[model samples]
Target: MLESLLDGIFNGISIGSVLLLAALGLAIVFGLMGVINMAHGELMMLGAYTTFVVQNGFKALGAPWSDFYIFFALIAAFIVTALVGLLLERGVVRYLYGRPLETLLATWGVSLILQQFIRSVSWQFAAGVGVFCLLFFGALWLISRRPDFEQIRGKAIAIMLPLSGAISLVVSNLLGQTYKFAVTLPWFGTQGVDVTAPKWLRGGLPLGGYQLPYTRVFIIALTILCLFAVFWFLNRTVWGLRIRAVTQNRSMSACLGIPTQKVDALTFAIGSGLAGVAGCAVSLLGSVSSNTGQSYIVDTFMVVVIGGVGKLVGSIVAAATIGIISYVVGSNALAPLVEFSPFLQGLLEFFATASMAKVFVFALIVIFLQFRPAGLFPQKGRTVDA
Candidate 1:
C-alpha cells in the first residue's frame, strides 16, 4: 500500500544520492579531459581504505575522541587521493593525452596495480609516502604561484612525468606488508569497524505511512551539498573560469595564456578528490574492501555517458533517472500493482530479479544512446579536437 510506495520512492532517492557522488567525478574527468580514467574506481578504493586507516587510528585513543573520527576520515580521504591524482596527471596521464585508447589501457593497468597493492601492502607505509607526495606537490604548487615559473609551468608536468611514475611505484611498495581490509569499532559494531551514523541519524522518521531511514536523508543532503559546492567552485572561482575556458576550447585558451596544462592537472585532481569523498560516504553503508570501488565503475560511467559528458545538469538528471528506475524495478515494488494480469505478472516477475533489472536498465541506456548519441545536454558551439 502506501507504505510500500513510499519506501520504494525513498529507496530510489537514497540510491540516487550514491549515484550522484560516484558519477560526479566521472562526468567532470570524462567531460573536460576527454580521458576515461578506468582507474577512477581505484582512487575511490584508496579513499575508502584511507578512511579505514583513520578509523583504526582513532580507535586506539579510547572513548570520546574516537567518536568523531568519521569527520576527519572524509577530509583525509579527499586530500590523500587528490595528491595521488595530481601525480597520476603529471606522470602517466599527461603523456597519453589525446590518445583515448592508450589512456584507457594504461589507467586500467594502474587500477590493477592499486588493487593488488591494497590487498597485499601495508596501508600505513603507503599512506606515509602519500603524505610525502602531498608535501612535495604542495611545494610545486607554491612554485606555480611565482611569476618566474609561469613560462616553465607547462613544462613542469613534462619534466615530472617520469618521476611521478617512479613515485607511484615507490608508494605502492612502501605500503605495509600486511593488509587489513576492515576495522573494528565499539560504537559502530562489535565485530567490525562500521561507519555508524550519528545518534540523530540512527533512527527512522515516519512519513506518508512509511518510515524513512535517517541515513538515507543524510546521504541525500551530502550529495546536494557536494553538488552545490562543485557548482559554486566552477562558476565563481578563477580556477573554475580557467577550467570552463579550457573546456570550451583548449587551443584557444592556451593561446590566451590560460595555462591549459595546469588546468588539466588541477581539474583532474578535483574530480579524483570528489571520487574519494564518494568512497568515504559509501563506506558508511557497506563493507570497505579492495574490490568495493570496482562495483560502482560501470554505473558511474553510464551516468556520465547518458547525461551529456560535459554537462553538470545532464549528469544530475541522468543519475536521478537511472537511480530511481533501477531501484524501483529491482526492488519489485511494482509487482503488486500488476498482480491482476497473469501475463504482466510473469513479465514483472522476470524483471523483478536484480540481474534482470540491470539488463533491462542497460538495454534502455543503449536505446537512449542510439537516439541521442550526444546525450541529454550536449555542449554547443565550437568543438575541440578529441
Candidate 2:
C-alpha cells in the first residue's frame, strides 16, 4: 500500500511537470504581453514535429548516436518554434495589440491555420483564403463603386494587399489541412511518429523496497532546470530588466527609449520557445503528433488561470496541487472507499473513470474560483487594471 501511494505521487509529479511547463509559457505571454495567444499550442506542435524530425535524422544516420538525439532535438525544437513565433508576432499579433477580443479571434484563426497546415487542405484553409480574397477584392469593389483611382482610398488597397497575404497564408494553411500537407522535407515525415524515451530513462530505481521510474525522475529534474533557468534569465539579465520594464508599463518604457515593440516580439518568441521545450519533454513520454499540443493546451490554460496569471511560483504550486489531487482522485487507490457506504461507492465509482475525473476537477476549480476570484496569486498594479 505504501509503495502504491509513493508511485501515485511520483506519477502526479510527472504530470505536474508537464503542466508547469505549459503554464509557464502561457503565464509569460499572457502576463507580460497581455496577449492570450490561442496559437501557443500550435507552437508546441511545431516543437514536437522538430523532435520527430531530429529523431528520424539520427535514425537515418544509423547506430549509437541515435540514442543521444534527444538533446539536439530539444534545441532544434526551441529554435524552430521561437523563429515561427517571431514571424507570428511581426505579421499578425503586433497589429492586434490592445484589442484583446480581436487578438483572441485572430490568434484562434492562426491556430486553425497551423492545424490545417499540418493535417492538409481543410475548410479552415478555404475560410482563411476566402476571408483574405474578400478583404482584398472588397476594397477594389468599393473603389470601383466610387470610381476614383487617385483618391486616398484607391491606394489603400495596395497597403491592404500586403496584410491580405498574411490572412491568405493563414487561411490557405487551414484549407490545406483537409488534404494533409505533403510537403515533407528532410527529417520530418508527413505524419505522426512514435517516440520512446532513451534507455537511460526507461527503467526504474529501487528505493527502500519500492521503485520509482527513471522517466519520472528525469521529468522532475528537467522541470527544476527549466525553473532555474527562467528565474535566472528574468532576474539576472539586462534583457530581462527591459522585459520587466515593458511588462510593468509599455508606454513608460517606450518613453524611456526602450524598444517596446522589439521587447514584445522577443517576449512572445521566448514564451513560444518555452512551450516548444515543453513539447520536446512531452515527446519523451508519449507519441509525437500534430495534435499532441492540443491535448494539454486547455489544461495549461486552467493552470495559469488557477495559479494566478504571471506568477511563476503560483503556477508551480497550482500545477503540483492540481496534478496530485486529480491523479489521486482518479486512481484506484480510493477503491477501499467502496466498502464504506453505497453512496460513497457510487460517487467514487463515477469519478474513477478518466472523463469524470476531469469534469470533477474543473467543477472544483469553478467552485474554488467563486471564493477567490483573483486566483492563487494576483498580479499588482497595471496587470490588475488590465
* All-Cα superposition RMSD per candidate: 6.4, 6.7
lDDT of 1 by residue, 2-64 (tens): 878667767887887898898888778887778899999989888877888788888897688
lDDT to native, each model: 0.80, 0.80
Clashing pairs in 1: 121-176, 122-175, 122-176, 183-193, 184-193
If candidate 1 were superposed on the true structure by all CA atoms, what would the RMSD be?
6.4
lDDT tens per residue, model 2, 207-257: 766677786787788788888988898899998999888888778888999
Candidate 2's displacement at residue 208, Å, is 6.5
After TM-score superposition, the amount by which residue 368's alpha carbon in candidate 2 deviates from its true location, in angstroms, is: 1.0
Off by over 4 Å in 2: 121-191, 207-211, 384-386
